[model samples]
Structure formats: C-alpha cells, structure tokens
Target: MSHENAKQQDLARATTDERAPMSTNQGQPVGDDQNSLKAGGRGPTLLEDFLLREKLQHFDHERIPERVVHARGAAAHGFFEVYDDSLSEFTTAQVLTDPSLKTPVFVRFSTVAGSRGSADTARDVRGFAVKMYTPQGNWDLVGNNIPVFFIQDAIKFPDLIHAAKAEPHNEIPQAATAHDTFWDFISLTPEAMHMIMWVMSDRAIPRSYALMDGFGVHTFRLVNAEGVAHFVKYHWKPKHGAHSLVWDEALKLAGADPDFHRKDLWESIEAGNCPEWELAVQIFDEATAAQFDFDILDATKIVPEDLVPLRRVGRMVLDRNPDNFFAETEQVAFMTTNIVPGMDFTEDPLLQGRNFSYLDTQLSRLGSPNFSELPINRPLACVANHQRDAHMRHTINKGRVAYAPASLDGHDPAATGAADGFHSHAVALEGRKLRERSPSFADHYGQAKLFWNSQTAVERAHIAKALSFELSKVATREVRVRMLDHLQQINPVLAAQVGRALGETAGDSAAAVPPSAASDKADEIAIFASAVSPTSASGRLQSTRGLSLLDGSQPASAAGRKVAVLAAPGSDASQILSLRSALSCAGAQAMVVGPHLGPLTGEIAAMATFANSSSVLFDAVFVPGGAPGVQQLTEIGEARRFLDEAYRHGKPIGVLAEGRALLAATQLGTLSGLTATAASGSSGSPAATLEAQGVLIADGSDVATAVDRFVATLARHRFPDRPLAAQIAA
Candidate 1:
C-alpha cells in the first residue's frame, strides 16, 4: 500500500466508535490480544508469530538511557512573562523585552548525581533547567539550585561526577556523597571549597522545589540592538522565599516518601497554588567585571549581590503539570547552547565546555539528530533550514533543491542577516593555545570563609554537623584529616567543630602534609598553602547579606505551609473545623490526622491517619480541646510520638483546654514554653500566651485568635533557638 493510503486509513479509523479495538503499530486490528499465538495450550510458541515477536521486541526496548547526571527529575508546563520592556535596552530578545507575550516554557527540576530511582530528598545539588519556546526560537536556561559549582573548568566535570557517584567497587551507597571517593576528590580539588560550604549547609536539602532559588551558574552576555554587550548572571528567586528541611527531617523523608519534592510540586500546581519565581539579572560591564578581585569567568565563584544588586525583569509561573512523565519530563532535553537572538556565550571554560557537551549529550541520549522534532522539544517558531534526512526525521521537503544557494529554488530558506537574526557579540580574543588556568581563579578559601562568616550561629552549627556527618562516613582516616585541613582554611571554628566529631584536630602537622606524599608532595602542600592564604585581591566580602537561609529578608508568610491537626474520638470538631477554615483563609493547608481514616468524634472526617503520617511531613502540629479525645490521644503512642517529634524538630505546636493532656503525655512537657502547666493562666487570647519557642496555648473559646497566632508562628518556619538538648527520641 502507498504511504498516502495508510495515512488516510489511519485518519478514518480515528473517526470510528468511541471504544475501538486495539491495533498494532501498523494499524492492523488485533483479535487475540490477551495471549500470544501458540500452536496449542501447552505447546511451544513458534517464531512465525509476528504479533508476539513485535510486542516482545518493542517491550524489550521501552527504556532509553538515563542521563549521567540529573537522571531523576520532575517537570511542569509553564509560561514566562516580562514585567515590562525594562530589559529592552540591554537585550533585543523578544522573550525578555516583550511584556505582552507569555512565552511557553517547560521546566525540569532534578537531583544531580542520582539515578532515576533515587530519592528526591537526597542532600545533593538540584538541577533547575527551563526550556522556553519563544517566537525567536527555543531558549534553554540550564542551571542548578546552587549559584556556584564545584569545579571552575568543564574538563573536570567527569572527574567530579565520577567521584560524587557511588563507588564502583560495590555501589553500596546510591545518590549520596558521604563516601571516600567523593571527599578524596574534594579534598584534593581546593577549588571546590566554596561549593563544599554550600552542600554541607541546609541549602542542599531544600524543603521543596518551590522554596529554593535557581541560578544560571555561569555568566553569559546580553547583546542589545545597538550591538552593546554586557555581562549577565541570571537568578530565579522563589516568590515564597527559599527554605530548607532540617537534616533529621530530610533523612526521615527519604525513607517515608522518596518522591516528596516531586509530589509537593505536582500537588501545589494542581491546587492552584502555582509555583512562581521572579527572574532577575545582575548586569555588569567589562570594566565593572575587571574591578572584581575574583575572575568573572570562574564558575566556582559568585558576584556578591551587594557588589551588584539584581534587577527584577520578569516572572515565571509553573501553572500546569506535564501530561506524561516520560514523554515530557524524562525525554525533554536542555542545552546550554540554546539561546535567543540577543544572547551570547562567554569564554568561561566551564560554560564553554557545557556548550559542546550538552548538544553531544542530546545526540547520544535521544538516539537521533532529529530529537528536536519531538513534540515536547519542538520550538513554536517556524523552522526553515536546508538540513534534513536524519534519523526519525519528521519534516518533509517540497522542492527538489534540498541544498542551499541553488538558483532552481530562488535560494529559499536563506539565513537572516546580522540585523534581522541571531548575531554573536563582538568580543576580541587574545590568548595562547596552552593548557593553563587563570591565576585570578585562585584563593579558593576566601569566599568559602566569607560564606562561613555570613551564616548565623544556628546555620553555622548545622553546617558543622553536616560536614561532620559526611566526613564520619569516610572510612579512610587520611581523607578525613585532609578534609579537616581544608576546612581549617575556611574557618578554625568550623574545622574545630567538625574535628571534635571526627575525634581529630584540625591544623595538625600530619594533616597539613599531602595525603599521597608523592615526589611533588612539597609542591602540592605549597600550592594548597598559597591557595588558602587570603589576600586583599581575593574579593572576599566579610559577609554577604543573603548567604544564610535565616536571613531576615525571607518573606514570612503562612502561604503554602502544611499543618497537621491531630484528632481523636470526642475531639472538638468545632475548633478543628474553625482552625482548618482559618488556615485555609491564610493560604495554608490543615490535614486532620486521626487513628483511622474515617469520621472521628462530631462527624469530623480524617484526611490522614496516624499510621500513614509523621510529624516530619508537617510544618506544624495542632490539638483541639475535649477530655475523652485528649485522653485517647494521650494513650496512643503514635499520637504522642507525633507531638514529641514535632517539638523536637522545632516545629510550631498549639494546644487548647483539655488538649494540654496530650502534650503532657509527650516529652515536650519538659520544654520551657510547651509544658502542660504553662497554660494555667487561663488567658483566652492565644496571642497573649504565644511563646518565643513557637508554642501557643489558649482556652478553646478563642479559636480565631489561636489560629491567627499559630499561623504567624508557623510562618517563622522553625524556632531553632529552642533547647534541643532536652529533646528525647520519639
């Protein structure tokens, strides 16, 4: 049959009955779909069964190779809109300058160094890649949650990933860097010091994809209509502000729900609480960049926000989830080279390497040069080119003249000249073709120290504990000591804190020596010594304002927060309903967790059960008044444990009237503000009794005031200053 006849028949079948019969790939209807063709009931199958052969063959090749990094990901469909034409003077790109056009976008959030089956809560760098289908073309802003990367040069990427991945000998630990190989590489690569500070901090374990900031790690150039070029760095600031999960919470969530981040993103969008981020850029000129002590081309560094404040230009809202995971999220490709007309690349070695690597990766992973023809990847702009006839080609050419510059077709599909189309920025180049790194990229520990100095006391402690936990897993003593020496360079206090946990001392003579002790050991130690010694030219800001997660600049709002309302038989249904209603009004969610998934006392249905829920999953916990319900909850071990865990994690806790009995049953009774006897004053107003420890108690009558105070406390996220030493295991 001719191709046209096959196409017509397929279209005719599409207009048939609603419940059509299943057909083969070739449109042949299958009658015996339940079983493969066989000679007899217990006989051997024959090779002549084309139906069985075709089905089995296709099933055998269902999966494509996963990415080497960022193998696990979740994606959503979205639109990006420029706030105004403010960026027009800097860039001629329509997507960045046109306020009326809502450019369609598909964004994929992923976990780096993890396989497709890895847990989402792993303490790893998160990939935040956005592919925008603009009128000009498809522009992919591939980046990560962390602003700075581990390595400055792209050639070291493979080595970095290989070391970070599970050890090849046993592959015992999956999706984790708390191992010997990773630390060994990091300890040797002094350039990773700054990134190590970030990965060890709470930033690595983000509370949710929507709560973390995204960054275009490498600096690029923005070219205007007048042919002026400026250095630019992109940032995606979450509208709700960046937040992170505690280490204990992250560890528990990894086992409780491997898809925690993915589920949160999907549900948030579905509930109409769409995730939004403001697109900001730090624009600078070549002269301004030259003044910075650190090299602007270094991927391992960041231009302090104070040095060059960000300019908010637009916003991106992910309002829709993908229809299919594999078709859109898994197969979608993002290349660093994908930029619009007004964008151009820099000579940053890491950025330069990514430009070549990303395209090659797509070719290898997608198994075809025509992968761009995939519906998820195809740009909205009209495509006109002489290139054709690759594997899986979708477009058909009309004229016989497929080649360019042919008079027979009037030189059709010609390239647009510089003024009308994409043009490279005019950058003069002068450099030798020798393998060398820029000296300006040195002083690796200065910014690392700056990060250490910027963090709050609690944040610094958390960083120390995280580093201790990771290094404790490294069985090799030399690697641990070497890492300690590097940490000492960042901060003596930080080094001492981690060293105490490791039962070793930082700056010891043994640790100062190179671990390998090669013939060039003296030279290696000298290099480390020189790299760590801070100089006036290190560009080290004593303290960066936004480096800490607890910075006062974060928006304190209860929106999108989740509170678990504990309920039992004979619980105060009115108070429960009132609290839920108030929390909903505040843009928060209140899920009633009971012993069983059914109506409890007063016909109040439970949305979650104690057995299926844990306090680590919630931002706060609340208990309502009722003698029988309070007594019942006091007796239930999980109920008591839930309250205990919530208190131990520094989450907000609220109790009213008889509900204090349940609080007394847990170890939280020993805490200063959360004691059962603390509410004896009989104050009806929750605000009057609000504790700095994040505990609220009041008489059951003032449900409105109680919810208001609770929501306000919950907005603070956590009271880390609470005495955790008094906490007991739940």
Candidate 2:
C-alpha cells in the first residue's frame, strides 16, 4: 500500500475514538456553553478568567485566508509509476525512463472561484493539480477539469478570476458565477468561449472527484537527453469515466450537503474504493505544431483526440486522505513551474508569466519560501538549493556557503555540471519585445463550436440554462447586451436566449466595465474571432457511448453502503431481519429507523438488529415496506425531511411494496412515473426509472430487482430531469 493510503486508514480509524467532549483549550471540561464564565449569574465576567479568553481567542483565529482563487479543494495521496520511457527522444527525466521506480504524489482537486467555505456542487471549472516527488525533483501538474482555459495570457488571469469571483459592491452570492461580471468578461474575451461551454455543461458539477478528468491547460516542452524538445499537453483520465450532476440536482445538493465533494473523496478512500487516473500526454514536434490551424501557445484550444491521441505514460491512484486537514490538505502547495529536469517551459506567454508568479503566491500563502520544507509540500528528493531563511524557516544549512560556489564548503558546495544539473533548452530569441498579443492567438470560436457540438442534448440544455441564469443577474442592460453580442458570435440561439433573459438585444455598445481594464485604457474593441454559426444549436445531445453514469461508475458492488429500513416500532421483527440479512449478503450495512429511537419488538430470529444510522451517514437509503412504520414516518416531519434531502442529493430511494405508498405520501411518488431504460431483459425501463437526472423509482414486480435498480440509481449520483422535490424523495 502507498504511504498515503496507510496514513488515511489510520486517520479513518481515529474518527472512532472519542477525544473528550467540548473542552477548553487548557483541557478543562466546560459545564455550559450558553453563557460565558461570570462572577455570578448576572455579574460582569472577570477579566482574570483565562479559559474564556482562550476560548474566544481560538474562535477568532479559526480561519486562514482562503485561496485567492480555487479556494475550495479536497486532497489525496498516491504514487505514480511510468510505463515505457519511450520519450527518451524528448524528455530525459529519470523517473519516466526507469520503469521500476515509483514517485510519491499528492493531488488536490478544487473549484476555481469558490471560497473555502463555499458549496462543493457549483457549476464551475475544477482544478486538478498533482505534485509528484521524483528522484530528481518535484513536478507539479497544475491543471483544470476542462482541457482548455478561459484566457490565453496569464496577464488576463487576474481579470478572469476577478470576473468569475463574486461581483463587487454586493457580496450576496458566494461560490457562484451566475452574475454579470463573469459573463461580461467571457463574452468580450472570445478565447473564453470554449471553456464557457464546458462550465455550463454537466461536467462542471462532477458526481465525485473519482469520476472526472483533468488537463494541463498549457502546452509545455519536454526535452530529451539529446536536448530535443517536443510540445506536450498533460491529461488525467479517470478509470471510473467522466460524470456529472444535473444542474437542479447540484443546486439541491448545495443546500443538502455543501461539503458533498470533500466528503465523497474522504469516504471513497476509506472505503477502499480509492480513485485512480491515467496520466497521459499529447506529444507533437514543431512540425506538427506548425501544421495545426491554431497557435500551439494558445491555452483555450486543444488538439482534438482525433488528431493527436493521448499517450498513456503513467498511472496515479489516490488511496488515502490527509491525516491533518490543516497541515496536509490546506498547506499543500502546487505550482505550474515545478518541473523535472527534462521538462521545459514554452514561449507560451501565459506559461512564462506563471513560472514567475507561483513562487510569489506560495511565499505569500505559506508564509515562507521554505514552504518546500512543509511536510505535505516537501519533496522526496534530496535538496541542496542555496535559497533559505524567511518566516518559520525550519532548515539549518550545514555549510557556511549560502551561495553556489567553491570556497568554504570544499569539494561540494551545491550545484552540478551540464550532465547532472537542471538544464533549460537553449532556444534563440530574436523577436523584439512587444506589449501586444501575437496575431496567431485568435480564432476562439472554432473550438468553442467544436465543444458545443461535442455535448449531448442534456449538456446543451444545461449550457443554455446556465447562460440564461448568468445573464439574468446583470444589473447593467448594456453589459448584458454586450455579453449577448459576444455569445451571439459563438451561437445565435445561445445569445438570443441570454438576451431574452436580460431583456435586451445583442450588440456592440459602449458597455465597458471598470475594475478590469484601466478606466482610461482605450478599449480597442473588435470581434477578434468572428464566431461561427452553430451547425445545429442543439449540438451533440447524446452521451458518448461509455459516458452514462449508471453504466460507467466503479466498484460495481456495495461494501460500505448503508441501507435504511423504516420499520414499525412493534411489528414483524422477522421481516426486518430478513431484509437486513439480504442487504448484508450483498456486503451492505443495514439500519432500521423505527417509530422511536429506543429498541423495538418483532417476532422470532427473523427480527433484525437495528441502529439509528441517520440518513446523513449513508451512501444510500432504503424504505422497507411496513404498514405501521411506513404509515408513521409518512406523516412525520423529520422522516419526510430526511427522505427529501436524500432525494435532492441524488441518492437512490428503494421501496418494498407499501414502502412505495410512504414514498408517494411525501412528494416522491411522482418519481415512480419515470422508469429507467435498462440494459436488457425485464429492464423495467432502467433509464426511465433513473432518467440519468436526479430521481429514480423502481416499479418492477420483484422487490429484489427493484432494490438492484435502486442500487444502480445510487451509482449514477443524481436523476436529472425530474422535479427537484421528486428527485430528492426518490
């Protein structure tokens, strides 16, 4: 097992231990929390009270600066193993060449705009950054869920983030970009169109971290031992297949469980269903780069899989969660510039700027350049860099030589020769320095059109809905119209829908917004990439053959899953026992929630043992048929709320006979109308029952088959098209 997995198992086990209840920082057990310590019940609190001061001080310091962007994230530990070092023609990286070697890795997944406290189910791009500690050095693949980015240049990065984050003046919204600032920026920046389509699709709201893909946004250069460089784009394809939640389901989840993504990551790792992704790259020489229509430096485009297929070089499995959330997950630092010896940077201006900025960001965030010394961020390789000393500096250089030189340290003071030292590709620079964008870095709509055309019908609908919602929030009519005009360039139907939502027409008006570009800076406004008319606005609406969630998710078995049976307080205990046994046979845990919290009665050994496992604790919940239990819970508020929240979160709702009535009594019966379109035989309309949206209802004659259908529904994550209320109950 990987070191990370072992650590996670230990952490998972630690949760079972009781660490003492509500104590002061000094370890004094508090008798009451409603009021602060005082001389008397009404007397003023004494200033000498150390416990109160300590408590308040600790509470005050509870937060750190969330990330400027990509603040919300989850992390896991893993290792990378290379396949064949056939890339000796391009990269001389030792880890890639040595098949027997393993590189320890840490990965953090995030959403670009949300704060650390934001909801996890937002429809936004995800950040997938991996830090691999190779023998030579640490290589961090800082990437995003979408293969492309919103802008081509890093100078525009601040602008993109500022726009996507909550709008200024009114901070009413959090972790969502359904406002004018984001659309206004993207509509003007044609390069953003391609990424915009993806953000609006179901892919942005992934079912879990295990079910999505990651991409290194910029094209980087890999140099071989011979110093020959080849451009490459990194990709991480999930073995479970790409998946997402329906827009409505995502919204419901925001309210049901804001930490949905993080929880999923922790639970999956602990359950022994660790997630894995294949690290691959699209490699091409200068000749191929020149042959492509778009500039190789452009971050907003991709070399379609049809053109240059990804070469699987290594695999990464995240089998463990962090032991300390603050130390490991929070303090883990990732940089785009953390490259190995053979991997080199391109003239790509965005990549160029990022190489310099990351160091500064890390220093400011981690409080020291010695951040490399942090346990989570520390590299496995030996380090002798001369750089040292800052706040919280932990290292003590053994030698007097702080700079790279010969003198005091004798034979070795650090640094190496051309054969052993890090080398940068020696490329000639002939062009005059300029402030303008390269002419070739235009034509944003082609790929945007390609992405739009690549999506399924459900995808396009989500896109349209997302655009409409974002535009609807624009306070300025002109800003709305301007955004629509740019979107119109990409697709008239999309622009028209957004325009209608904003009550305006698409046009080039003086709709410039301040705080992005300098107020005095002349806006040389021109539609750089004239958007192509969408071939058919609906785009591709069918899931790629292997993309369906129910058909694609992993494990394919119930191990740590929870099955809840709403049994009667004093009814047939045997029936419930039989039910629990069946579930246990399938490797599932079963809990019975009776009319009351105390022990209940039933007849014979058939009566099952029950525990009060709240719906919150289960991956999936079941409703076993019991006339008394079903009748009792159907009329109760907490029970209804429990089912409601579960359905809203896209968990499966299994009913046995009368369990269906209890479900219908709440607003869930409407889900029964929707059956799943199955794989085959008595399929009982698996697709209809689950509908790939947010709700799934089983109406098959057999209860076990219905349970199987419900289990499959749980695998899918959410039922997409059903009403929000119905989806939650089912």
Candidate 3:
C-alpha cells in the first residue's frame, strides 16, 4: 500500500471506536438506547418516553426528496487552474484567464435516470456537473458523458424523461431505458436519433467516472472585454482518457458491486491518484459558425473537431472526497444559468428550458429559495443583492434597505456597468410570438450517421450488440420495429445487424414498418423526419477521430487500474510481492485475494478473500506460483472459477510456475491455439508473446522481467483481438 492508502486505513480504523457518550437531538444524555421506555418492563409504553418519541420523529423525516433526475451521484472537491491567460482573448471569465488563482470546485457525477438507491453501474447517461467558485461568482458547467441530448427542445424534456424512466403503469424496470415506453417515445422523436446512437454506445457504461469525457451539451456565448461574442462549447477531457466497460462486464458489476463507479472514484482519490481533466473550449465566431451546415445552437448536434479545434485553457484536479454524502453531493444544486459575467446562454431551446428548469427544480427539491447559502453551492465571492429571504434562509440581511435604486443607502449594492457586471450579448432579436422550431434545426439524422461512421469496428459491434439487447427487452413488437426504422434511417447496416438479432428479416424496409397500433404516432414522426432533406449530413465531415474512444488519441496506461492477486496457503510471497510492487510502481492498485483473509504466509496479507471479493471488481488478475498454494487454490471452487470467469471476460491474467497448473485446470487452457509462453519453446520476445494473447506465464526465473511484462499486458486493459470463441462457457 502507498502512504496515502495507509493514512486512509488509519482514518477508517480511527472511526471504529465511539469516543463520546450517546445523546439525544438536544444533547440530552440517553440512559437507555437499546429498548424504548416501557411500563413495568413489559407493559404498554408511556408518553413520557421522550427518547423514543424523538428517535422515531427524526427517523420519520430523515430522508428528503431525491432529485427528479441525477439523484444517484458521487462528488469530490477540487481546484481549477489555468495554463495561461490566453483564454482572456475569448472570454473575460477570471477562472479561465487567471493562472495564479486556484478556483475551488465541487463536481458531482451521476446517472440521469436512476433513483438515489439505484446501482451505479447501470447503462444510463452519466451527469458531469461542475460548480466552480471563482472570484467572480459560482459557475456551474452542468454537462454529461455524451455531448448531445435526446431532445432538442426543452419543452419536450418532461416527455423524454418520462419515457426514459420506469413506465408509470407498474414501474417494473428501474434505472434502465430498455422498455416499451422508452423505445415508443424514441421512435416518435426523430430528433433523438443522434443521441440514441450515443446512449447505445459503450460511452453510456463508463469504466469509471474518472475515465469518461464530459461535454457542456449546449452551445453558449462567451463575451470578451470588447463586447464581442463567440459561440462556445465546454469540454472536459480526462487525463486518463476515455474508456468503458464491456457490456458483459457492466452487467455482472451491477450485481457484484452496485456502488462500483462510486467506490472507484472515492478509492482512486484516497489512493492519491487524483483524477484530472483538461478544460477545453470549442470557440467559433459568427462567421465560422455560419459556415457550418447545421445550426450551431442545436443541442443535439456537435461541431466536428476537424472544423474547429479545441483550445486547452485550464485543467481541474479532484483531490478530495466529500466529507458527507448528503451534505455535499446530494444538496449541491447545479443550474445551467449560474454562469459568470463572461459567459452567457445561447438560444438553444433545450438550454433555455434547462436554465429555468434547473432553478425551479432546486427550489422545490432543496426546500429553499436560499439553497445558494449551502456551503457546497455558496459562491466564494461576496454576494451583495437586494433579494430577500425564503425557506431555510441562512443570511440575516441587515439594514432596512432591501431594494435597489434607493437614495437612502446611496444606491449601495447597485449594479455595475458592462465593464464589470453581466451584460447580455447585443445580438439583435426580432421574431414573432409563435411556437415553432427554427428551420435550421430540421436535420437530425446527419450527425447520427456521422457518429456511426466515426466508430471503430469493435465499437460498432458493441453498439450493435447494445441496441440488440435493449430492443430485445422491449415487450412491444411495434416499438421494436419502429426503433429499427429509425436506426435504418441513420445507418442501414446497423438496422440490419440489430434486425438479425431480433430474429427478423434484413434489408427489407417493409419489415421495419410499424404495426397498426403505432399508426397514430406515424404522422408526428414524419413531420420531423420529412421536413429536412438531410443534405447537411452529406456536407458534414465524414468522421472525426475524437468521436471514437478507441482512437489513437486515447492514452493507454496502467495508472488507477486495480489488480487482484489470487493467493492461498503457501503462496509464493516473493513472487506476489514483486508483482504487487511492479503494479504499484505503475500507479495501479494490487490486492492479494485468498480462500480466507489475514496472513497468507510470510508478509503477504490477504486483503480480500474469495467469499468477499469477485473477479468483476478488479481490472486484472494475477496468480502467483507455489506448489502448496496451487494445490490449495485448486481445491477452492471459487478460486479456480475466478480465473475461468476472468478469462471469459477478456481480462488479462498472469500465472507463475505452479500457478500454471491452476490455469491449465480451467477450460481456458483447453481452448484451441492457447499458448503458455513459459511452456512454449518458440523463441520470441516476452512482450510480443504475452500481449498477443493477454496471458503471461513464467517459471521461477527472471522475476523482475516477468512481472514487468505482465504489468505491461495488464495496461492494455483488454485484448479483443485474442482468438477466443464467444461460445466458450466460463
């Protein structure tokens, strides 16, 4: 363990012993805590049992209303610092321009559709909301893992959420969108096709909150000191680079560790592997924006990186976990309108709706119009305003002057001029009072096709598999076919692949025709899909490498990875220690797992046992060699099964000397073309040999070389190229 983890362990142990006497809510000492006060020790309880009354009363109201969305979340405290003041040329936001000031930030990551108690590993949109307390004010860049949203207009948000959430009839499904209602709504909403592609991709199921990318979703305006405005989109590129769990791994993790992503984030920070993201902005002037085929203000579209490159301005590092989950993570409110003077909202319908919706929802959920007074939401800059108190108001506004423009207080707390205070961009507005979408927002499937074309072969396969799985769960055949029609509009190949999985005919558009029950919804879908010719899609860039997670831009490193070292009685302490040391040196975590906890002979401590840990919890597994250890592990069913399951999941495995016998015992060893480098006489470099098959084998020689090669193989995360049959049962 590292020094940071040691300190964390100490802190955890320190909290085990209660130091203070138990007391009531009023600090009154409690004489009896176990049993409620009763008459004659068995008779009816009396009203004088103040302790019981207080306990039950508090318990009754202990839980507050969870968020309407993003209820399940994890949060951390951090600081943001700029690389330079170059951003000043684009915007006057001090947080982006000042390199000397480290702005304090609280970031909350969440699953959008899940309740507060839902599993963290659910395949749902992950919310990436950041509240930065700059010198100017609190700026909240509320975003998500995917850049686009399902709906283009904020008015349709309620409908979108209603469809994505559990069906209202019985609420059978929880924290999942694979149901009739969701697909039914999705099929009718053509504007959502682009976002659907993203949701079905592996990005929806992130490996960890620290590894996924975040985007501000809506395009906004950044005003400079000269009163010039530029369209901007915020992006947070993870230093570890974007990565995700395979669908099978994700499914198993939801059961094995419901708090998997949350625990991963908290533990990574505790282990001193603070997650970092570079804050970049895609800035384009009015002329540049006009050059784009589609509207720049469309929330469901993305500006290809090839057209306008990202400007890296600053970086954020989350180094501290929240002291209290509810006090910090739950109560923290992120409003889209909470931007500083330099930043302003665009006319994107979804964004305009969100600006009002966020504040309105916070008022009801936080039980206060004064939620900003909460520590996590409070601005670092001094607040001076004429606004009065409401429920849960913490500040006692002194003096009688509560309104501005009054002579009594010399117009104190008065608004400043455009140079200092917020000034809306001077873009002229002239429009009739009508409910209509802009003609510019008509093309929807173009970007969806672009996203499809951008994916690597492996990613495309995953997306197809995901779509197949989700549609398979839709009980309504009409809903499934309707969705296939939309998918065909985006990519005919994708629709055909998914169609095959549903046991339906391929290449025939008639087969995708909605059933008679869905006829009523057809006209609505046609209105959106038929209005535009989708000509803009042809002019759009063919593909952008940035859109793919498997592209060469993503960094491949072992840092922050967790490895489980399978061990048992008479385990080779030397080999385990060397491998653990190597992993730690690469900034990864290594834990020894055995049949039981505590000493596994010598200095090697069994951090977790088979009974308590599962292979799903770790990124990789290593089996250390020892004659006795191998024999013991062979007898332990879970120990032997662990390797088999790990192999089936495509996780990298390392085996030494006698440990090879344990591997040979599993079905993995019997697979055709399986090669154990230690036993194979073919002369080749160890890196090439091990990496080719994601399996490293070694005898009792060259311990350092073997461990180094094993660690390298583990860094690759997964070897999809390995020739292993999918039909092989673990």
lDDT top scorer: 1
Give candidate 1's root-mean-square deviation (CA, Å).
Answer: 7.3
Which ranges in model 1 have alpha carbons more than 4 Å from their true place? 1-20, 412-418, 508-540, 671-690
Between prediction 1 and prediction 2, the one with superior lDDT is 1
Predicted model with the maximum TM-score: 1
Worst 10 residues of 3 by lDDT: 523-532
Summarize candidate 1's per-residue lDDT along 229-273 as a digit string, tens digits: 999999999998899998888999988889999999999889888
What are the TM-scores, per candidate, against the unseen true structure?
A: 0.91, 0.76, 0.90
Task: Give one clash count per candidate, in the order shown.
Answer: 0, 31, 0
* Segments of candidate 2 deviating more than 4 angstroms: 1-64, 84-89, 412-418, 504-621, 633-653, 663-730
**Model 3 / residue 536 / CA error / Å:** 12
> What tens-digit string does per-residue lDDT give for candidate 2 at 1-730?
9997676555533321365455665666755543566889799999987767887898897766668988889999988888877767778888777778878889999987888888999888898999999998899999888878788888999998888888778875688887778767876787787787777777788867877888998899888877889899888988656666666667767876788889878977887777888888889999988977688898887777656877888889888789888888889888887888988888888888788888888887877778889998887888766787778788887867677666674756464665765788998888887888887887877777676555544455567677778767777677776767677776665565455456665553323222222122121111112233434365522112222233333335454355666666544465456556666665455666665555665542212322333454455666665567667767766666556666665566666555555556555544444311223434445334443443444444465566556655554544433445433433
How do these models rank on lDDT, best leading? Answer: 1, 3, 2
Report each candidate's C-alpha RMSD, comma-separated, in the order given: 7.3, 10.4, 7.6
